[model samples]
Target: MMPNRVIAIGDFDGVHRGHQQILLQLNEWAASLHAEPMVLSFDANTKGQKIITDNRVKDWYFSQYGIEHWQVLHFEQWKEMAAEDFTDHFLKEELQVVGLVCGQDFHFGKDRKGNEFTLISRGITVKKLKSLMVEDLRVSSSMIRTYLEAGELEQAEARLGHPFCLMGEVCRGKGLARQYGQPTVNIPLSSRQLLPPYGVYAAWVEAEGSRYPAAANIGVRPTVESGGEPNLEAHILRDSPDLYGCEIRIELKAYLRKETRFESREQLFAQIQKDGEHSLTRLEMLK
Candidate 1:
């Protein structure tokens, strides 16, 4: 049977805390009206422009929040539809949507000619969400990206309601850390994936349902040699169990510092010591 009502649409790019608020509202409204809460998102490859989060990662986050009935629609054809036509088609023919929930800055249709007023005028109920403020600043996906690019993981997590994460299968590397008595797990990054600024960070490493506190580095290892491939390597704290060939998720908790080349191995070791201490302290505070 067709649900009598549906909460319509939004970009939902990162699915950060601000986006969560809108989803929660939709869930509440849907329950009150005995309707289904639907999330209309975009497939990363199909989106007209670049986005901050990939489709898989966005879907993971949404699933974590218990959102079902998710729809990842292609944006290319939708972008060509006129504002009114797009709304008429999606609301009436496709979804039979009775209401819509979206951020105040939401825009849609060709040239983004549609607004909350336009939807309401079409006899569709619309809820325009006010900007969500966190820590005296507006919480947004762009702001989160800025913080990540600047190596401000803590600040980004504050806005995201969780640590910034990278997911990939473990791969073999030069094994330099192992030679130096600190074996690590390395993950190769694809070009389309967003990387935190080159630096060390405090992180939580998760694989197959278990999580561990760890010290991680994201950079070209300038100390060993110059012009090498950039890599992400994490040294799981005090644990020596095998993780080779496993898929792992790394949650960046706090930025330690920018990648630096030291004059001697002794100096580099001393800096790593400081980073380890800082990582433990930050992880404790987060707990």
Candidate 2:
């Protein structure tokens, strides 16, 4: 007999609302069959390619939604693996997956040969879900990425069912915010991750199980360093937890303004103060 499982296989890039739908159905099936909900996903990000969700954050979200078994397939190792080997060796022998779920557009294996029929041929049960629609738009990762690239945050968030977030370690900064006395956690943007436009945003920064409203800047310090890696600086309203070297997750709740170079430090400081107040007001509305 096959080991009990309801395996949902896909890139599941964003785990957007549509992806959640498949996972939710898998949950119901797993509960009914007394099986576990398992997810098999890729951990690769192509160069110059943007994704709605980065792999690190995606992994955490998967666990939060009750996925018991998580299998991350390294892109380099399995990129050339055949569909036959994938089923016989990986799924059958390795995972012992008895049931499968995926979107209608799901494709996998070498040369993108695997499909719904491929899994069925291996004698595994398969469920192919249709893409979900929201606001007359097909809720999809690619669509959401487009919205983010264009800085249409609210539209992207609507399809995502959550705010667009950036996750990184709070690195040491050049001590600009300290001059004003409130601590700002600086997060370096990874080249592997997708970025919204360089701008100021009303955000929520989460650290060590607590979330704080913040005014954040997503850009290199154009005023200070003419050229620098893209960095995200979030000034948590009324809280500073010695976040240096700490990992923090900042969700872009709303876009506030485009990043601009000020003629002087005084101008920048004044604008940041206004941004902090506006960010607080926006966050209050979220509550």
Candidate with maximal TM-score = 2
Give the C-alpha miss distance for residue 127 in model 1, angstroms.
2.0
The sequence of per-residue lDDT tens digits that candidate 2 reaches over residues 117-193 is: 88889888888788888878788788888889888888888888888987878889889778877668997776767
| TM-score, cand. 1 | 0.84
lDDT by residue (180-279, candidate 1, tens digit) is: 6777899886666667889999988988888888889999878877888778888887565578899888888888888999898767767776777788
Off by over 4 Å in 1: 2-5, 44-51, 223-229, 262-274
The lDDT per prediction is: 0.79, 0.83
RMSD to native, candidate 2: 2.0
